[model samples]
Target: MKTLTIRRPDDWHLHLRDGAVLEGVIADTSRHFARAIIMPNLVPPVVTAQDAVAYRDRILTALPQGDRFQPLMTLYLTEGTDPDDVAAAKESGLITAVKLYPAGATTNSHGGVRDIDKAMPVLERMAEIGLPLCVHGEVTTPEVDIFDREAVFIETVLDPLRNRLPELKVTMEHVTTKDGVDYIMGSSGNLAGTITTHHLIINRNAILVGGIRPHYYCLPVAKRENHRLALRAAAASGDKRFFLGTDSAPHVDPLKECGCGCAGIYTSPNTMSCLAHVFEEENALDKLEAFTSLNGPAWYGMAPNEETMTLVRQEQPVSYPSKRDTGAGAITVFDPMFPLHWQVVE
Candidate 1:
């Protein structure tokens, strides 16, 4: 078996829903990642420091026994989010970042900010306090084509915002288009992007080629092949500006399989294996540590994990459960559409 060892990685962006779903899914992440920036888009949304603390408590309580995982809490950015409360949460070391979800952009995001002007106070506070703002990075205007939203967001939203507040550190979460990649690369270091495992592996074609593949559908939905290639290059390029964020948003099987299904790809269970395969295929396995472990912490202004994990690539393909059982319902696992040979030998 071929083996690779590196500092244990942390998912820069993740979503573990509340209650039974959170309990059922937290282990998949805690098993492999040392820490994760938990998404805050819930039913009512985590809008305050108090809400963040409570959510963090639930996440910690739900973690499997003996697991050494940490959940870096985030407050969902809404028009009414309090600036002083956000600064306090960051100062307390409980809130790692604040997430910006454009209103009605994705699942459970109705409470997201509809006007940047209304959110300026909170954004200014975060920038002054050196807290990062993690953005969902898509516009919700009905006229903008879904596939073109990311690029349009750069022109009409992200660029203007950055110009207004260059000191603010921003993470463009789960970027899917080359336009997004190029924009991040050309921008100042204060701006960085997270490339999800699914975005790097599948293109829009995966969702439409052989009938409608709901499991492959995700928000900022997968782009064209060229965009996928761009994402892979960015991930493997050893650029500190880019890192791993699975955006492993999970939905119950029923919710994902019906008419007008939810948008997300559940990838926590086998993200490392899939990532290993991608890096190896790109001949950049040597740089995988930077993409998976080092860069994220560097961008977030934290140290990399002291812990280490080893991955073994055996001749036999790795096997993963087709679906994960949750009290809410059965949730599907991401299938990379190719055999994975690397398994975390924890």
Candidate 2:
């Protein structure tokens, strides 16, 4: 067996839905990741310091025994979010970042910020406090073609925001387009991007090529082959600005199979195996540690975990974890569509 070991990876972006779904999926993430930035787009949304504390408690309760996982909490940025509360959360280390989801952008995102002007109070405070903003990075305007949303948002929303507040650390989460890659690569400071495990492996084809595979559909939806190539190169290039954020969102199978399917792809179960395969294809397996482990910690201003994870390349392909059972429902696992050869050794 060919074995590769590196510092344990962290998920810069992840969604652990509350209650039963949270209980069922927490182990898949905690088993491998030392830490993850838990998204705040809950049903009612985590909007206050008190809410963060309660949510953190629930996450801790859901964590599987013997798993050493830290849930880095975040507050959801809304038109009415309190700036003083945001500053205090950062001061107390109760929250790691603030998430900005444009209203109607994705699942449970209806409460997101619709007017940037209304959110300036919290945002300006984040800039002063040095708390990062993790953005969904897509505009929800009806006229913008779904495929063009990411680029359009960059030209209109993201760039302007960055220019206005250069000190506000920003994490462009689940970046799916070449425009996002180039923009981040060209940034001089206070900017970084998290490339998701699924985005690196699939393109728009996976969603529409063969009669609508809803499981493959996600917000900031996958783009063209050229864009996928850009993401792959950036992730494997060992650039500190690009790192792993699984955005490993899980939705029930029933919800995904319907006409109005939800947007998400659960990847925490086998992200490392999928990543190893991609890095090996690029002939940059040595750089996997940088993308998966090192760069993310550096961007968030935290030290890399002392613990390590190992992947062994087996002669046979790794078994597919087609679906994970959460008490709420059966959540389908993301299928890379190619055989995974690297198995994470316990």
Candidate 3:
């Protein structure tokens, strides 16, 4: 097996929650990603330029000493989001993009946009400022089946948004279905998508094969086997439009195991190792560099990181954290679908 080394990768999307939980989990991410687009769905939400700056500072302070990880910030889009605030944050470089979460769609998303149509003013401002809108593309309608939420979202929300605001740039975060891949490939230039590590490695069966695995349950939850195959194809196609975004969200073990579990997958620790295994399996190891390193920066209109990291194909079993002591009792670490045989060579 050939050993591969390339520029350090950037996680285009991540959730490094604030306070003690943030302190406990930031290191695993810093060890792997040189930078990451920090999500803004905090309890109150990072809704303004000031909020973004303060959050960025907290992340910087939380980073392990001597580490050079940069946390790119984003604002949570809401109905009342000020256009000037969006433009100011982008201009000041305090925020890189704006995230639109359909209210009630995901964790701590109650403060998200209630009506997408009503939020066109904010979208228009984003387009004018050249700030990309990263979206949690599932609709929250009660009538939509859980499995079909993503596809339904594309038909109802994304398709209309694309047509209405043709100039607006958007990134569909953590896409898990064939429809998502096809839509992204079809839209090519104006729209792009971020495929997460867990989505690429597991399908719905992995969640229900033996029992209901809560760790495998995430927003825009894993799709059917055929969709999983489609996602793998897109990632290995050597396509620049598809790239890495770990959406490495963490929840204390109790929150995940409670009656109503939180929606997120903590994959920071094994992200790159998992991706290496997937690409190698597809015989697309040659294109892994572009997917992990080149594509994310290109999509964000930034330069690829100059530093390099290496990975070797070796069989090793890494332990999953049963509980992380994040000030609370413990937060559970998510397990990717299979045994990871490849590991990053520090």
Q: Which candidate wins on lDDT?
A: 1
- On a 0 to 1 TM-score scale, where does candidate 3 land against the true structure? 0.97
Clashing residue pairs for model 2: none
Q: Model 1 reaches what TM-score against the true structure?
A: 0.99
Least lDDT summed over 10 consecutive residues: which range in candidate 3?
Answer: 315-324
Q: What C-alpha root-mean-square deviation, in Å, does candidate 3 show against the real structure?
A: 1.3
Clashes of 3: 0
Question: For residues 104-197, could you state the per-residue lDDT of candidate 3 as single tens digits?
Answer: 9999899998788889999998887789999998989999998888999999999999898888999999988999999998983679999998
Per-prediction TM-score: 0.99, 0.99, 0.97
Task: Write one digit per residue (lDDT tens) for candidate 2, span 1-346.
Answer: 2899999999999999999999999999999999999999998999999999999999999988878999999999999998998998899999999999999999999999899989988888899889999998999899999999999999999999999989889999989898999999899999999999999999999999969999999988989999999999999999999999999999999999998999999999999999999999999999999998999999999999999999999999999679999899999999998899999996
- Error (Å) of candidate 3 at residue 52 is 0.6
Please list the C-alpha lDDT of all candidates, in the order they appear: 0.94, 0.93, 0.88
**Candidate 1 runs further than 4 Å off:** none
Q: At residue 141, what lDDT does model 2 achieve?
A: 92
Ranking by TM-score: 1, 2, 3
State the local distance difference test value for candidate 3.
Answer: 0.88
Model 3 Cα shift for residue 5 (angstroms): 0.2
Comparison by TM-score, 2 against 3, better one? 2
